[model samples]
Target chain A: MTKREPFFWITVSCGIIVLAFILLPLIEMLSAPSAVMLKETLKDKDVVRSIWLSMYTALAAACISFVFGTPLAYVLARTNFHGKRLVESIIDLPIVIPHPVVGIAILSVAGKNHWLGQIMSELGVRIMGSVTGIITVLTFVGIPFYINAAKDGFEGISPRLENVARSLGAPMFSTFFRITFPLAWRSMLVGLIMCCARAISEFGAVVIVAYHPMIAPVMIYERFESYGLKYSQPVAVWLVLVCLSLFLILRILALPKKNRNHD
Target chain B: MIELHNINVRLGQFRLKNIDLNIDSNDFFVLMGPTGAGKTVLLEAIAGLVPLEYGRITIAGRDVTGTAPEKRGVSIMYQDYALFPHLTISQNISFGVRYHAKAKSESGSRFERLVRELNIGHLLKRYPETLSGGELQRAALARALMVEPQVILLDEPLSALDPGFREEIRLLLKNLHESSGMTFFMVTHDFAETLSLATTAAVMNNGIIEQAGNVQEIFQKPCSTFVADFVGMKNILPAIFNKHTSRIGSLTVEMATIPVDTGGFIAIRPEDIVISTHKPASSMCNSFYGVVSAIIDQGFSYEVHVQVEDITFKSLITKGSLIDLGIREGLVVHLSFKATAIHCF
Candidate 1:
């Protein structure tokens, strides 16, 4: 593409500023943390436990997003009901609202004083300071990624394709599972990776809800406050490497195929 | 056989009200209409995609108003083909086959046989995203027919294909309908499809069937001025059949040497209205002495507009004749056509 005008220069400048402010810190972080220190810290009992909690909670949160959010995403993608934009705006709230605010909101709905939490408590379930609280907070913050991705996936499929399938002898629900979902599965996969990454790195809401069964993020923060940057660097390095590798893999997977079947 | 009785479908902006039509088994029915005439809606209604607001749709003598699309035993192909992009051509065709049978073994074996018969046996492994428009359509047909649907509905299936590929698909569709004996209902805005493939044609306007008949019958003998004009009738006027003679209707019928049957307003095709710059001899059919109102060249033919009394009609003539006659506006000419050429409804 040819350089257009001053607008092009302005866009480039803005891009430069964003990368410098956000990515430079990550670059510096990689250079400062040695592989030796990270390897050594991997053996730490608390470090290992926090890593385990992060993986499990992220997995649980991703599963929850898939189960509950997918149908809602599909509905939002396919239909044009009243207040659809409003519903979409509401789904996007978690991504924009401060993570701490997300914690407060989740607490009002599912905390000790909430009806949902009390009902679960009656069934011998606990939320505050428990693994459930950690996963719930992670899920709450990470849901937007899954919903948005799945919605785009479903939207990419023409409704006519589903119509043709239905006309050919597939029922309503069967058409979705057999045709619509599979075509958009690659998009859903990218969404899954994003949801998992978001869940693992979730700090504000998870910190507020259940800092006890410390996921890696909370552990990093505690170590930074109590023992300073040196103790937390190893965990941060490990998290970054894991997230980046998965992101690359998902990017490759999401690209649609290209080949011609000549008649 | 399929029939629609007073079928009413109300979509967002387009509505099909009081539509009634019938098609026999092994018929190639073409729904020809202008844009937004609810042709697609009517096709979808038959395929059981869009719900019927009122009236009933009967397929093969069975009431299918309440039945779901799959159970209705209809297969529809859209203009875009709507092949599952994630699945290969063979897989896409086999999809519906496998889908209906709970056992994988039964569907797989049937799909194999279908691909072979459709002559797309080689494309069973190529995904829809990778197929050309023609390939996708063949695969889509294979898939739809694999389940042995009672009727096939095509939604402008030729519109998306490149010009070179359209004829092949048309021939393929024709042969398939012939050999398979499947009732084929197709919607197309293109007039050529109606000419080439339609055994029966319906001209839809403002969500109503303005006219319908066998393709040749409708084209040669249009029922209304709408059908006449749409079917390339360029000279339609509100002229009375001449009552001065032993005539059928009004003054528009003219002093026929041989009396025509019933007539209200006569619509003569531009091509049928012969134009001669000089007074022609008596060997002609219906001759009208007129003055050339305007002469416009249309590259291939001259669009010669002639006026007689209050009536004005267009006559198409070759440019070679144009040079010979030196035809121009306001020049007197003779227009003639056979009485049998006049179609009255």
Candidate 2:
């Protein structure tokens, strides 16, 4: 074995401490519940519905962010304009704002006093105590992650490649689809997984906006508040398991490809 | 054919100022300059890749200043090749075919011919990162040719290749230019590339074209001091001309003909000056006695620097001549050259 220095040992010790800090609570919660308790939790109709609702809403939020954020991300990556920094800061505001504030901000825009809320009422679209409110809050908080990731992806590509493509008679639109999109899609996928993960783990905003259709986290909180640790731990364990799977998928997708294959 | 009139481009602090150039159809035109001279910027402007502050660019009789790069019927190849990383070599070469109806119709035969000619048939399925530098260069060239563009702009195409690969691609570029009848506008700092491949050339400096003309004319008769220095004229001195005689430093050098201007710079190619141990009775107009200052070994030849009065002249002599004359540092030597060898601008 190679000789290890004091600095190396110190770094390894710090890394182990960090890993333990993150993984200890998760491992204890997952192992606390017995197989019978997990099976019983799975059989409960409310728990199952909450878990499914969380996954569906989070996935919907991710899809909506991808559709709307991609063009904005590309523009940010490729061009410099007046107040671009301001626009970028605005995009990131959701991440900095408290989750409850995000919920209140959405309600303020969608409630009856505001013009947009009046229009929503006229359209018979409700943003309170509904799945729409949950998705809206999730998207508001999750889009910044998607846009930042996709912008970094686009920035990594050389504008020279696009120029060469255009010089070869491919127009700008065709060049984007043919050249830019293929190179950047992996990063966008990673961003989508990250957005989904963030949306699924959300509790404060979803609880404030839509407590009636309880997502998994809200169910865990409600169970913890009403029953105790024994009732809430199983649902928390299931949510952690789902988030862990998404994290693993993101890691696998983010690995540097071996010989251009996603292996 | 390509014509650029009053082409002015400002990119941040750098600018290409008031440029006028005319390139003939079927011409291998090379732009030579130092780094940061805006040669690449000018090439990009011609391809419509950069926005020109003020200019009119015409390609094959069509004014295309406002046209997009695709509509201008031009293709550009970068030094790095810039092949799409996600694409196979074949896919990269044929990527532009789908956008042009005529090119799409003729792509099959054109693709085969380009692959065969470029000797990249085995590399069709390989990605750009997997290929060697020369391989990427051939694929990029093939892609540029596949579109059948009216003009092809190459930005220092051979600069990134090894010497052996440079020669190989240089020959390929010359052959492609001859066979395709397409206007090939290339930018390079290598005089060897310009001499071997260019039918006409221009020298640029600090974002302006210093001189543009026949390749031989530009080399022999540079219009400015910057062009002369950039083209390897090692001996440049300010001179005061009076009829047939010009005073350079403290030495009065004779000229075959009188110059029109009173004072200007004179440049002499190093290879033209002959070094001798003893002053000989010769008809050459200029001869000066000086001590050898330094002898630099230039692989193929020795550059003997001789100081006469306040001027130092560099002469390129073969090893055999060095041995024959017993030339070394601190040796007193006589340098002689005909007055016609000096180029005044």
Candidate 3:
């Protein structure tokens, strides 16, 4: 009791500081607008269109991450192959680099200067300044988070389960789908949601690469720059409201309730 | 029929080499070994989970070396039971049954029958997390058996259970073996587990079978010093082999010894030691003058540690017998054993 004099006060102060840092902006934005202002913001054609595009592209980027990143994550989690360390580091490269750098690199690669863009273009596909370009940036920025989360999920699963599945008439792929995937799916779903959210929130790379097909974050930024606080606040509030709802739902769905409660 | 011929697989830091085994169509075989002795690897190899670098695996007379495990008609139930927590008991059982040629109705009926048989009919809709360890074990067995696999592999099926409930599971395993007549190849390091259900015993060490024989013969005769030690033989003294009996050492080291050597080695279990302070006139042949170094109270019996020169041999005596003998530390005692308990590798 002698030492308890100010410890509880310090804890409350820390909590207040964190809440001010994280929740204050959201509260201000939400409280700034009336119901009419919210409805009017939702009524904006460009805002609605960008929100739809953002949702679809974010989903596409998440799907892309799932396809390519899961197996890579599994390999990282399960096997020790040559060049694995280098591959893992490269997967995390987009996370640390500046978003504008990511944007520049994507534009440089898919802007007639690289073979991949040329190949896609040759196959009657266009990437630069298109919806595909937006998805490309979203996936490039968002995948490392997905891969890292999925890898940790897979890593937490005991290898014995996969081995058991394999021995129980499952091939390598069936073992993955039946045992490994289901066991790691909750965490993978969390990863996917976070990836989708991160991709949706992306502005810099999308702005550089595919600003014409404006996503929500870029639109928000554009409104702020062109017409200042009043024009942007309503759109920002609408977008944040939707994004926050989706994020909360996904987070609830992704929790391993049985595991947490049992422990 | 399941067989392995010259199977070879190299894992990091461990290698299984030139392994050969044959199990009858419906025999329950136990594979006993120390940890990292490649028991699970061998089971996985037979089940075709992991590819073999070199070997031929024939299951039920079909060459399944490159066959997928699903196509091979085999199932493995692991120590944790590996029951899918996402599915109910019945669904878990029926997940793989469709791969079999049985009609859907018949498969469903079969799953129902297995559920009832395993005493888990009430748990058909329950998630795996809700069930007890024994219940999960039953469900896992039901799932593996529902497919009517040609062979079932059990990897340390009881190692995860509470020790108090192990015997109950062991009896359940025994019942499964007897009632269904399914071929079960269980991998366990616990040798004292009931081999009554196992038609044959295959003891693995490092990466190879040290011995494979009838349970009694394996207990009675081991092929190597490792097998002898692993099979719970406590006193395996060096002996000079002369046919079926070997003297503990030449007459100089030990006195009045007999050998049960097969090729050139002998082993004696601790339970076979006969002790007396008054020097009983038994014709068991082997006798030694040693000082009692320690007395260990095992749950079932007392392990009397006796040191004869540099060699320390542990002899097990019952608690009642411990009372009669007044066994204590630092007492000079006369120890003796029977020739039948002495085995040669």
Give all candidates' CA lDDT scores. 0.82, 0.92, 0.82
Interface RMSD of 2: 2.4
Q: List runs of model 3 lying over 4 Å from the truth.
A: A1-11, A33-43, A74-78, A117-125, A156-184, A255-263, B103-105, B241-265, B309-311
Error of 2 at A69 (Å): 0.9
Query: What CAPRI class is candidate 3?
Result: acceptable
Per-residue lDDT tens digits for candidate 3, residues A95-169, read 898999899998887866689878878887776679989999999999998999999999998886676555455
Model 2 residue runs over 4 Å out of place are A1-4, A250-256, A260-263
| Per-residue lDDT over B142-253 for candidate 2, one digit per residue giving the tens place of the 0 to 100 score | 9999989999999999999999999999999999999999999999988879999999999998999999999999898888888898888999999999988899989999
DockQ, structure candidate 3: 0.41
In candidate 3 chain A, what residue range of length 10 has the lowest lDDT sum?
Answer: A254-263
- lDDT string for model 3 (B181-274, tens) is 6788999988888355577888888898888868877876777788888878887766666554455544322223444443355667888887
Question: Which one is best on lDDT?
Answer: 2
Pick the TM-score winner: 2
Relative to the real complex, the DockQ score for model 2 comes to 0.65
- Candidate 2: which docking quality band? medium
